[model samples]
Target chain A: MNLKTLRDYGRVIFYAAEMALRSNLTDSFVLFGILVQPIIIALLAFWMLGDRGGEYIIFVVIGSGMTGLWTSCLFISGNSITQERWTGTLELMVSTPTPVSVIVIGKILSNVLQSLASMVLSYTLAIVIFGYVPTINQPVLFTISLLLTILSYACFGLLISPVFVLNPDVQRLQNGLEFPVYVLCGFMFPIALLPGWTTPLSYILSPYWAARALHATSSQWNGLGEVALSWAAMVALSLIYLMLSSLLFKRLLRRARLDATLNIQ
Target chain B: MKAIEVRNLRRVFRATIGVVRRKIKEIVAVDDISFEVYDGELFGLLGPNGAGKTTTVKMLTTMLIPTSGEARVLGLDVVRSAEALRSRIGFVFGGERGLYWRLSGYDNLRYFASLYHVDPAVSRKRIPYLLDLVGLSDRGQEKVEGYSRGMKQRLHIARTLLHDPQVLFLDEPTIGLDPVGARELRQVVRNLQAEKKTILLTTHYMFEADALCQRIAVIDKGRIIALDTPEGLKTYVKDLAVIEFEVYGVPSNVLEQLRAQPYVHTVSVENRDQKQALLIHSPRGSQAVPDLLSMMNGIRIGNVIVREPTLEDAYVRLVGGEA
Candidate 1:
């Protein structure tokens, strides 16, 4: 509400993010999601779509990179609160003056930023292994889209962490929720190929708009109008997610306190 | 001057059972407990396992909303003003689980300091001081995972003091510490109390409570059975004397016979190596010792002695006779 409070929140976020990054460096599962899995997916995409020609190489790179980002968000960021619970720090985090959501935002920021290494790795794979140079058709627009993607993805992650913590049954669906997003977001192929009924589901997901924006900028220029629409969708969805996540966090705390389940690992 | 006030605070947990036909069972963890902790006083909640000590602390710390009634710390209602109160009070739930194992002790302190909104300038100076105070300055840079359990417990104490809160809650702070470590931690608690910090400590260790707390509340089965100073509690058993018998192979039937005696207040047994130490509490005092020894006719009796009742004896009786 005040500047000092905001500054305190900002510091908490940065501190939380820094600690998460430090802690995540040794996690083999996180390393696989951010580093190894994306490269494997990119290699497979290159071999599978080789017949599609050189122009599609950049598309595969972006698609595979986006898959890495979604994977990290789904597994790492989604489990942020649950991880705290496991460590027995959820009670401490909740007891702090700073809001738990701010701390989680910081953790999501680190995971997303760390996952960006997937894009760099994919680009390197194309350059070194395949002897191909992939360039962004619209570098400035691509950069803007990248920033919005991070914001939207962070917000999306915000919604997920609380849900997973509150409903472990939904968390059991985590592995199942991964590849569907890749297909629905058209990470390796166009969603246009999917059944019409699922289009709305894809449209509702911020990652789909992110993939469309990135793919359009990297391989094909779908037009400024289309890119702007994707940006609008991402921005709007991010705001909605932020608002919804606030409600979810409130409910989460209330339910946890009432049920006395915050410390029940 | 009251730092903490609790009025008829109660918490009921609904535990669901069965896979197909679910049944919700209500468990009253804390039932209508009322007390006040004055500022600068060291208060102890003494109880055995499942005595709702942790539940009471959780409610006061605003981690769990009371199922009914009220708890206020630092003049703020725990439920209504939780956010405002969090920074003003500190707590440690006894364990090795709370710290970030991957992070160094210093970094863990830094992280929690920021969470408490401690000024960067203050934290920079205070972090090293706290590390030194907890005797971890030499190892502060090492990952917490490498620290011993006692070291981790000490670090938890330092972590809670990051904001210099006025009110503190410690739930079983020395649960598993060795004697020396537990003694050192108790000294630290004493020093905090000396600095005029109001503290509420919960522990099953009666000696720790006796050594540290100015006043103690003995809770059992979701109720406060006794609230008094160590001396005051000891008085509850003053009418009785404790007689001890060191014997090998004391039969259960003989133990039951001692318990069944009209003059016997309570009988408890402690198993030592190859022997059982029997403590019999009664108003009959040493006069009953001969009869008690006569009852265990077949046992190999070693040493027999009579002593005055202590806070632990009072506690055992108040909690319904299990030490």
Candidate 2:
């Protein structure tokens, strides 16, 4: 790309982020979902674990926080295009000189920022209320794991974004996928606890490795090599999802143009 | 060079009906049609609802792909060079939904400016100027959700003008606005034309087309049935005179009686503020006015006038029966 095209893309990303932030700030329901849901899940985890909760407090905190992240990705990032469609802005966006992929990426970036903020809020609330602060043996690895987890989830959200455009019964699919993903990705528990057949599914899910890497880095139980492997797997899976989502984005635009569905629906 | 060139453009939509036993239906939203719009001309596409006006505009704006033929804007193919063409053309569909309601009107314009890659320095100056031009300078800081329908429509125009595009396609820009709001928007469109910009406008309002467009195309059923200058089109009804009269409470029988007159070609009734305004078409010119008054049977006639055929009369004559 030339300097001008690159500059235009940068502007697209910048403006998209600004709009998303403005929208999220003004939406009380969304703010409540992002802030309150994680705290409720953290409290539930605290009560359920009881006597053994001390050691697993960090695990539950991170899991519940990741749940908020997952919700943001699903509702905010994945459904953004559908929201645009409903608002009648999707066609206008598509007609712009900037590629749709760049616009979607900008949305993902903004949602990721919001998701990270939610994670931080969840962690702080857990620490303040429950008084359980685990020792992080490798702070650098934990930070790396956190960033990768957010990036991978953003890619996952992008992958599913096109499905909403193609299918009309997307709410059913969206509702059905949420809990299954939480279970399959081992958000609140270990994949070893799940059935044997589900292990392969967990292995391929980016969030499972993300959760694993986070837990290992926090507990310092696994060596640097194992943590690096988990990070590598997450990055590789994220790359694959991003590539697939790009193809899906192109197909979605082509289908929308051919069917004249962008403006109508 | 022609600002826009459409050659045999067409668009077909596949619609599925029923649940268990589904059937596929093919709809020709835009049939094979072609037209050219010259630079610095205010062109109008006059059509009724579901008349393929929006479909044609979508094809030229690169929002929808044509099924069989081609369209070029600013010498670039809409399909092959959409990215470059987009920078040179802008469009606004009538309605208030296309904007981000949560953002302020100024922010909305700024966001669109960024999308079009307008320089920040230029946009800073252009945005306020446009906001002022659209009469929204005072409301620019207000969130769009708080604005009225007219304000939103005005903001839409400002948003489209952010990137100083050479050509603009506006599809029914004033569909649901009040008369005052519609008049304001028409004035803005006229000003845009005065700036030497090429514009393609589509509306069902004949007077609007007559007042603004240098050339108008009357489209119906996905096809252009007539294309000419306003005066040229009006000449089609040169021999016909329209007798328009208002009645406070005219019954349907009186309308039927008027229609039964051999000299009266057609009678159309329009309800205005609880009163009925009847438009009678006849080749007898003002000579038929005396007969129309007598047929009223001493009914409360408020205003009666005999005038030459308007662009609306010409439109009704051409597409009245078929549409």
Candidate 3:
């Protein structure tokens, strides 16, 4: 698209994100996923991996935080379009000049941002409740990795929102789709512990790359080359997801409009 | 030039009914209907529930593609150029459901303005102007959930006008509102029309159609049975008149007998508080009233009155009392 069109989409994204954040402020279920769930996971991981020594504090914090992010992505960002349908605004959103995918990107951005709070909370828990210090070995690299992680997750969420809307049979399995990703991505543990056959699945998931980048930057300095490779994988996977999401969005709109299912809650 | 052109537009829904056997039923919601809405004209599609009014509006607004045939708004094809058409057209499906109930009315307008690509600068001024236009200026900060159905509907009107779209489609804009609220909404509609905006309004409320629409199309069973001006539609029953009589209980066979009588067009019974008001449409008018009493000699009758046929009478006749 042209610059002007891009600017307009950006404006929509900003407002839609703002709206999503505002509406989410009072949602107890969303709060639990973004805040409570991660803290609980962090607490459990802290005790389980405590024997690994104090150096692993940052690892526990990052791992538990990724769980919160994935949970929010799975429940909130994934259900963005479905939520609009429930509010009876799906048809209106579809009728607008702005593409629904842009609005959904805004929502995913908000969800990911909200999910970051879990990381901060886990860090606080390690320092205050557990009496441990968490540090990032490569602060600059970690920040860059965090930003890319957000982008990758946002793109992943983009792919997820349409899939849930277009195929409810897939959506029906949403509850079961969560822990598998957490396990495959090694949110609180390394994937080397899992069977070798599952390593391919972990490699394909952007989350696993994200966890690797964050864990490497936070606790151990995995060499710049390895970190760069993880970053590249996330970037490439994000682009692929973004392209696939656009296709899914087109299919979703056509199916919903043709089947007259846009308003079906 | 026509503001809206629909040529043999149709929409069919394939509904799966059975769980085990999986039977698919095809429902023709809009069946090969065609019409043109002229520039700056207020047109009404009057039909009862499930009469394809909404399906037609949805197609014109680019929310749904017609199963066959074509629809255009402002010279832009709805299907092939839906993206281009969306910015030029606005629509509101009436009810409380379409709004973001959690957001303040002002926030809702601002959000929709962004969706319509209204410049932030323009929206800053336009939002308050629209809130004032819909009489929600004072309540702009209050969440929509607190607003009455009328207030919510007024907000819907304000939301649709955000982009200053050239053509507007309102599907049942005042379906479940108090009489005062309904009147206020009608006034807003008139105001919109006076601004030279082309409007296509769909409602089952015949009186609302009669009071507002410059031209109307009576739709029933997925087809446009009649298209005419308000006065022109009234002429459908101009040759006929309504004969009314109040009775406690009218026998079903007697009502049937009245229908079989000569000069009697249609007989309809309306339940009043403690009595039934029987309305008979006939060309004979009062001339047929005397024969009606003879036929129900033993029935307790109250007051008898004869009146001119109304647009409602025309609708009842056109749709065969389905309204």
Candidate 4:
């Protein structure tokens, strides 16, 4: 990978998000939808887990935050390409020798940056307004969980990049990933609450492990001691999804015999 | 040195169905077309919509892999040395909406300039000159979104040239411009010609192709049916000279008589000032004009005009489609 190319992509992604904010989107709209949306969902978790709901708010906040990042990952990636199509700018991009990674990296970095900023803002509000900071035994261990959670979610975002290539219905497609992830993974509360086989199946999904690991981090349970073990599971899923997504992207790139220009009319 | 070379390129896209079904529907957009664009020639891939012109351009530019066959740009094998090939070339795809709308045209240029690895300081200096070249120097600070279509198109051209590439692939360079804007764009093409830049231009406008291209490949349905200079192709088809007349009070028999003339290929009867008119086609233009005008009698001929067949007529004949 060319470092310059990577830098170039990062610049593009940063510039794109900045451009988007000034013109098409509102500060409140992006903040409220991305940050506040999860908070609202967390309230539902509070209501459901009433009377002993401190742990549940943490679960809901983590889960909702995970979902928030999750939606934008694929959504932004897909929309960046589709928006390129929608706005008619993709052809100009494809014509240059700019590495394809620049596009993916640029898009993800922009979304990641936005999501991270939004994540911080949301957590701030939650701590002040909702009166919650995840309980932790060690700051160092909590930092590791935070890093891993981010890495895992980021990989999740990258893995879904190829769907944009096949056919981009960005908004609708983004909405599709939300409910299933929330229901199957105990993004809020516990997996035991999910009925039938979803409990077992949810364990296999990345977010389920992500929420579980975060919960363990907050509680200092036996599951927390297995934190080192958690890396292996998260890394395993990250590798699989990364490889699969890369292959899918390569295949689609080959098949996508599109000119640098899509027909405008 | 040949700047761009294509040999029997074939690209087939599989139009896939939904998730469960797997079937390959072959869309042979570019099918086995070959040509060598010599260094510094303004070569044109001239065609109408769905004529595979852009596909051929894409294959040469290394955007789409040719399913079979080969291409080399600036002596680099397109498939084998794609990165090197891509880095050396500049490209402008017509009707581009991919620019950052909020960024000033200057900023956009500078961004691409950065991608080319140009030094920031040099980019700052070079940008104004390029913007000036494209007639957007003063407006460079303004956001691209506010610029008119023609201004954006000019800026797009300026952006492609940011890296100082040896070859340029301009697909439909002047697609949707007003007549004056079209003239300005054609002038830009001519100026690029003066600089001796190797360019592959794809255009729907026949006149632009005729005026600017040193050689043109008339493509249709994924293949080049004819390749030559505009005049050379025109010569292949029989040149027709047409003359139109404004006349009045001519009898029905007189219109038939004009068509019966050995030199008059076609005649049309119409009343101009409550009079009769005849449109005649002949083998020769100026030579046939005088002879045809002298024959009209018993009816006043207001005015007579003669002209040679245009490139539009030549293209129609080349495509084997009657106009």
Which candidate number has the best DockQ?
A: 1
- Please state the error at residue A164 of candidate 3 in Å: 0.7
Q: What local lDDT score does residue A260 receive in model 1, on the 0 to 100 scale? A: 82
What is the per-residue lDDT of model 1 for residues A1-265, given as tens digits with 9 covering 90 to 100? 9999999999999998899899889999999999999999999988788668777998989888999899999999999988888888989999998888999999999999999999999999988988888888999999999999999999999999999987899999999999999999998899999999999999999999999999898787979998999999999999999999999999998898998878755
Native contact fraction per model: 0.97, 0.84, 0.81, 0.48
Runs in model 2 with CA error above 4 Å? Answer: B248-262, B289-302, B321-323
Tell me how many clashing residue pairs each candidate has.
Answer: 0, 0, 0, 8
Task: Identify the superior model by DockQ, candidate 1 or candidate 2.
Answer: 1
Winner on TM-score between 2 and 4 is 2
Best by lDDT: 1
Sorted on TM-score, highest at the top, how do the candidates line up? 1, 3, 2, 4
Candidate 4 structure quality by residue, lDDT tens digits, B130-149: 99989999999998879988
Q: What's the best-to-worst order under DockQ?
A: 1, 2, 3, 4
After superposition, candidate 3 runs with Cα above 4 Å error: B247-254, B271-276, B294-302
What is the C-alpha lDDT profile of model 3 across B238-261, one tens digit per residue?
999999899999998998898898
Q: Candidate 2: lDDT over CA atoms? A: 0.86
The best-first sequence of candidates by lDDT reads 1, 3, 2, 4
Best by TM-score: 1
Q: How much does each candidate deviate from the true structure in C-alpha RMSD? A: 1.2, 2.3, 1.6, 5.7
| TM-score of chain B for predicted candidate 4 | 0.79
Cα deviation in Å at residue B27, candidate 1?
Answer: 1.1
lDDT of 4 at B303: 79
A262 in model 2: Cα distance from truth in Å? 0.8
**Candidate 4 pairs with clashing backbones:** A88-B97, A88-B98, A89-B97, A89-B98, A91-A260, B247-B276, B248-B275, B248-B276
Pairs in clash, predicted candidate 2: none
List model 1 lDDT by residue over B1-323, tens digit each.
Answer: 99999999999999999999999999999999999999999999999999999999999998999999998899999999999999999999888998999999999999999999999999999999999988899999999999988899999999999999999999999989998888889988998999999999999988889999999999999999999999999999999999888988777888788889999988888788989888889998989988887888878989988999989899988976776
